[model samples]
Target: MEFTQPVDSNLFDDAKVVGKPMQRIDGPLKVTGTAPYAYERNDAAPDALYGYPLGAAIGHGRITRMDAEAARSAPGVRAVVTTLEIDPLEKGINNVARLFGGAEVQHYHQAIAVVVADTFEQARAASALIEVDYEEGTPADLDLDAAFERVQGTGEPDTLVGDVEAAFRDAPHVIDQMYHTPAESHTMMEPHASTVDWSDGEEMTVWTSNQMINVNLKSIAATFGIDRERIRVESPYVGGGFGSKLWLRADAVLAALGSRAAGVPVKLALPRPMVMNNTTHRSATVQRIRLAAREDGHLTGIWHEAAAYCLPGGRGENPTAQTPIFYAGETRRVKNHVVDMPLPETADMRAPGEASGLMALEIAMDEMAEALDMDPVQFRIINDTQVDPANPDIPFSDRHFVECLERGAEAFGWSKRNTTPGEQRDGDWLIGHGVAGAYRGALVLPSGARAILDGGKLIIETDMTDIGTGSYTILAQTAAETMGMDVADVEMRLANSAFPASSGSGGQFGAPSSASGVYAACMALRDKIAGNLGIEEASFNGGRVTGGGTDMALSEINEEVSAEDAIQWGDFQKDYAMGTFGAHFVEVGVHAYTGETRVRRMLAVCDAGRIINPVTARSQVIGGMVMGVGAALSEDMALDRGRGFFANHDMANYEVAVHADIPEQEVIFLDTLDGVATPLKAKGVGELGLCGVAAAIANGLYNATGIRVRDYPLTMDKFIDRLPAV
Candidate 1:
């Protein structure tokens, strides 16, 4: 079904299940520990061997010699495969670094060898017996400060709209500043793991933890130089991804190789420390923002330049991606620069570009508001634009940015906030309020699904993954709404390569795109049923089909029916600019004596089109809020520049938000729909919640202490000495 234009009448208009707050259907299995993860699939691979991987000790080097004789002779050890012994494997299409079978190490903790044994302990013990000699080389640049000087443009030098320099110079109000953000880890609950069973070198089946199952199937096939149909990938449940599991990792590749060598199925689970260094991470960024506005608080020119490090063939982080669309400016410029570094592969995490970009841009907005002596919320309202700032001809499909701000401010009691820092005090605490706007583009991809109706029960099958974002529940809701049945009556089978491919969870596009696919498949099924009954049209309600002056139970149809369909794009994306908008309001209390900041309350007003399931959408928004809090005040992956690796590579040293750290959080979704997005009229809300959240917290800290911080994590040390006297 090609979505060429706005849907005339969607099934959700009188929805009984789609918009309701429904509990997740998979919750019972997860809480009872009945769900099988990658490494715990003992029932399917009962005779599976355990594989322990050995990673490179040096970041950049060549393996001169490897001695695995002792490991081969170790007790219970079945086989030991090293990079020196195996044939060089081709890099997967979606992979930036080769998983295994290479002499030259590209980054720290690159997998070097794998030892398979009868038990996990045996494999771990045997792995330590292998010895390797490496020839180290001069490390690549690891310092963002020094690398910024040698940074090169990434493809297009800059996004130029008008005369930016002239507009900035002529503006009456101008603010310029530089901001820095450190590298971050995904810190998902489950580690990267996989279980592989190869059959006589002809076919392979892998039970793995990943986001995109089809991508994994193709990549694994490419790496093994086998037919695409020869591999089957299954990821029934994923603990969490946050973009870390979007591509093929070393766990699956090594497990497949180990299984082949040992003549038995093998399972590999990356250790805690290895998950940090061997996988991808969000790269650090250095951003410089210049805002020029008129005296009346209208923005005239906005210039954002960002530089970040990436591997030689990797994509760089673009922190200026949201600058050209956020506000109405006569002139704007955005530039992205990439610096070569010898570090772990950098990739998307959460909102990626917008997360770090807004951390700087929103703070710059707050600073400019102060320069104009105006309310920050009012300043944002004054520069609101309904059309794309870069190309005014393309208007936004549905934008409620002003409504988000006004509603959030009213709900958060913005009128009572004290504007002057250090003036409002309660005993030993200073109080302040802050606000930041959120923006993230809504993206849709080609997605397909199959629906089967058997004896009044509807079953939907797709390769979409949950990844803790409620994909299963929302898709079930879509099926239930379309079939005119309760959500409990619909069974959803997902994340299996055998199922129809879907838009696997990433970039906040999973929900809308996958659900639209389900909608199309259901529509096809409805048409088939109507044609079989010899009616021109049919209406479904209360498990009964009515058409042509006849009503009958849907289950009375003797023959089973099934249909499959896909949602393809036409020209909607090219004609209109579609994005999700939100507003974050935060209240903070600073300890006058210790200079510590504590969040008192938080609220997010989002306009992300029609929400499929409010219960799941709220959970996603709250999770993002917690992550944003960590980004603002705690999370930072310290770099060991001398060694070209992350210093705090384990969870012990890396601090994230605990239950006690988060106060009460409220999420309010605006009643909206975007016809240009899909037939479902729903957009993504996962990444939009975190877009401007960190900046709001930083702005609150500044309002409370009168000290502005341009660096991320907003650690207490950055403002301890600068805090005013009690």
Candidate 2:
């Protein structure tokens, strides 16, 4: 089914399950501790040996010597494989550093060796016995500030829409500032783990914790120099994957290599410290924003330049991506500069570019509103654009950003907020209110699914991963709604390469794209059922086909029917600039004496088209809100510049927002349906809930103490010295 035009009506229009607040069907298994994570999949490979990975000692260098004789003789140790024994492996797609093989180290914690043993403890203990010596290279380039300075006079900007400098010079109200967001870890509950079976030299099967199965299957086939069909990747249950597990990582590769070498299945799970330093992280960004506005709080031009560090030949963090189309501006300039730093690999996490970008851009918006002495929410509304600012001829398919702002302001009691800082005090606390607009472009991908109706049960099979976002529930709901059956009667088999390919749960495109695929497959099944009944057209309802004077139960057909189809989008994005928009309102209290900040309450109003399941959607929004709080006031990966590694690489040293740190959070979704988005008429809300939340908290901090700090993770020290007098 090629989606080219807007859908006027569909089976989802009168949906009974798709739009309802349905509990997760997999919740019972998860809470009962029966759902198997990758590391605990003993049933799949009961005789699997354990493998422990050894990382490089130096940040960047070549190994001079490796003495693994001791580890090879260790008790229960089966085999020890080192990088020096083999040539460098081919790099996978989107991988900046090789997973294994060769002596040269591109970054700290690069996998260099694997020790296989009878037990996990035995393998881990044996790995410590190995000795390695490295010829350390010169200190790596780990500083973002120096990189920013180096790119200042290099060349023309990456993107230049119009005369931004002239617009800034001629504008009456203008603001220029710089902001910094430090590196952050995904901190997902489950670590990177995999279990590989290669006992049969002809075929290999891997049960891993990953977000994308097909992508990993292809990567594994490429890394092993095998046919794509010879490898199978399965991830039935993933505890959580913000974006870290989107690609094939070291654990799977190490396990596969160890299994092949030892002639037995092998299981490997990266240690907590290794998960921090070895895997991908959200790169730190230094962003400079210059906003030119009119006296009426309307934006005239936006100049956003961002600099981030990455391995050579890797795409860096893009903190200026959202500046071009977010608000109304005649002239806009957005640019990104990448610095070749030999640090850990930096890649997508949660919202990725928009998360860091909005952390600075929205704060700048608040500052601009102050310059104009206008309400921040009103200022945003004044600059809302229905059409893309870069290309005004193309309008958004659907946008309700203004409604989000107005409704959020009203619900959050914006009128009660005190205009002046330090005046509205609660004894030892100073109160403040802040608001910021949220933005994330809607995305879709080609997805396919297969539906089988057998024994009065509808089964949908796809390679989509849940990742704790309720993909299973939504897909079942879609299948049930399309086939006129109860959700309980539908079975979902997901995250297996044997199933049809799906969107694979990333970039906020999983729900709509995968659900559309299921819808298409069920529509195919509906047509087949109708044709078999000898009806030109039929209305399916209550498990009966009613049309052409024929009314019969689906179960009475006596023959098993199956159909497979996919949803392929056709040039829709080219004609329409579609995005999800929201508004975040936060209330904060600052301790006047200690200068500590505490959030009082928070509210998010979102407009992301039709929500498939409000229950899971709410959970996703609140989870994003918690992560946003962590990004605002707590989470930061401390870097050891001289060593080129994350110094605080464990949970003890790293900090995240806890339950006590979060207050009351309310999420409101606007009643909206985007016909052009999909036949399901739904967009994603997972990333939108996080986009501008950190900036809202930053604005609240400023409103509380009258001190503006551009640096993120707003620790108390940043404003303690300048706090108002007690």
Candidate 3:
């Protein structure tokens, strides 16, 4: 099904199941602790041996000697495989650092060996016996400031548009500042885990916790130098994945090798510390933003220069791509650069670029508003652009940014906020209110699905993953609404490579793309049913078909009907600018003596097209809001510059947002639909809920305290000394 034309008056226009606040159908299993996660999948590979991985001690070095004889001779030990025993494996195209079978250590915690034993405890205890010797290399480039200067001096900017220099020079008002955000770990509930069974000769099955099934299968085949058809990956349930499990990790590869060597199935789960340095993280960034505007807060030129440290041949954080698409400006300059560093691989996390970039850009918007004596929300509304600012010929498919801001401001009582900083006090605390705008581009991918109708029950199969985002519920809704049946009659089977390929769950495209594919498949099945009943045109209702005054039950003539189809996109994506927009309002109270900030209230207004299921959509936005609070106040992967690794690797030291830290949170979704987005007229809100949340909190803190801290994770030490006198 080619999606080239805008859909008019489809079944979704009067949807019965979709767009409703339906409780997640998988909720009972999750709450009852019966959901089978990757590591707990005993049904997939029974009697699987436990495999424990050994990481390198040095940051950057070559392994000269590895003695695993002790570990091999330990109790219940099945086999021991070390990197020194085998030639280097093929580097996967999706992996920046090699997963296994490598001598040269690129970063700290690079997997060096795997110890397989009959029991997990035995495997873990035996893995500690392995000894390794390494020769260290030169120190890594861990300083972002030094790297930024080097790039500024040597390399050309990544993007340059209209004459920003002239616009800045002739502007009536200007604001320039540099902001820093430290690296952040995903810290999802689920660890990177996998179970591999190779008992069937030359054929392997891996049950892993990964976001993308097709991509993971390909990576596994490429890493082990096996045919792609020889491997099958299944992850029916994932505890959580904030873009950390988008690709294959060392756990899967190590488990496969261990199972092959031991002649039995093997399961491996990375320890918490290993999960930090061995896997991908959100790279720290140094961003310099210069905003020039007229006296009335009309933006003249926008300059955004961003740099982040990354490994050689790796793409780091792209925090400046949204500058041109976000606001209206005649002259704009956006530059992004990466400095080569011997650091752990840094990749996507949640919203990725926009999540990190808006932590600075939206705060800069607040500062510019202060300089012009204009309201922050009003300033954003004034700069809203319906078309692409860089290329004005293309208009947005559907944008409700101004409405989002207006409604959010009204709900949050923006008029009641004190315009002057440090002027509102509640008892011994200073009360302040803040707001920030949100933006995330809408994206789609070709996705396929298979629909099966057996005895009146509809079954939908796809490789789409839930990732704790309620993909199963919404997909069921789509099928039920399309077939004119209750949602309870629809069954969703997902997260298996054997199923039809889907867009997978990442980059906020999973819901829209996968749902559209299911819709296409359901439509095909409808055609088949109508044609079988000898009806020229059919009105499907109440599980029955009627046309030409003849009515018949749909299940009566069903001879095991099945249909498979995919939703392929056309050039309409390039013809219009598509994105999701939202607004965040935050209220905070700062202690007068300790400068401790506490969130008092929070509200988010989003306009991301039609909501699939409001219950699950609200949950996703609330989770993102909690993560944003952590990013603003506590989340930081402290880097050990001398050792080239994250110092606070454990959860004890690396603090996240808890229930006590969060206050009241409210989310409102504006009813809307995008004709160019999909047949469902829906977009993704998983990442849009988080885009500008941190900036709103930061701005609220600045309003509570006169001191402005340019750095992130606004700790008390950054502003304690400058607290207002009682």
Question: For residues 56-122, could you state the per-residue lDDT of candidate 1 as single tens digits?
Answer: 9888878999999999999999988899987778888668878898688888899999999999999
lDDT of each: 0.90, 0.90, 0.90
Q: Model 2 — which ten-residue stretch has the worst lDDT? A: 152-161
Q: Higher-lDDT candidate among 1 and 2?
A: 2
Task: Give the root-mean-square deviation of each candidate in angstroms.
Answer: 1.3, 1.0, 1.1
Ranking by lDDT: 2, 3, 1
RMSD of 2: 1.0
- Model 2 lDDT tens row, 1-726: 899898889888888888999999899999999999998888989999999999987889889999999999999998898989888887777788888998899999999999999998999999999899999998876779888877854667766778888999999998999899999999999999999998666699999999999889888888878998888899999989899999989999999888888889999999988898899999999988999998878888898888998888887688887888899988988888988988889988998899999999999999999999998989999999999988889999999999999999899999889789667789899888889899998999999999998878888999999999999998999998998888888999999999999989999999999999999889989999889888898887777778898998877778899999999998866799989999999999989988888999999999999999999999999999999999999899999899899988888888988989999999999959999998999998889988999999999988888989889899998989999887
Candidate 3 global TM-score: 0.99
In candidate 1, which residue ranges exceed 4 Å CA deviation?
152-156
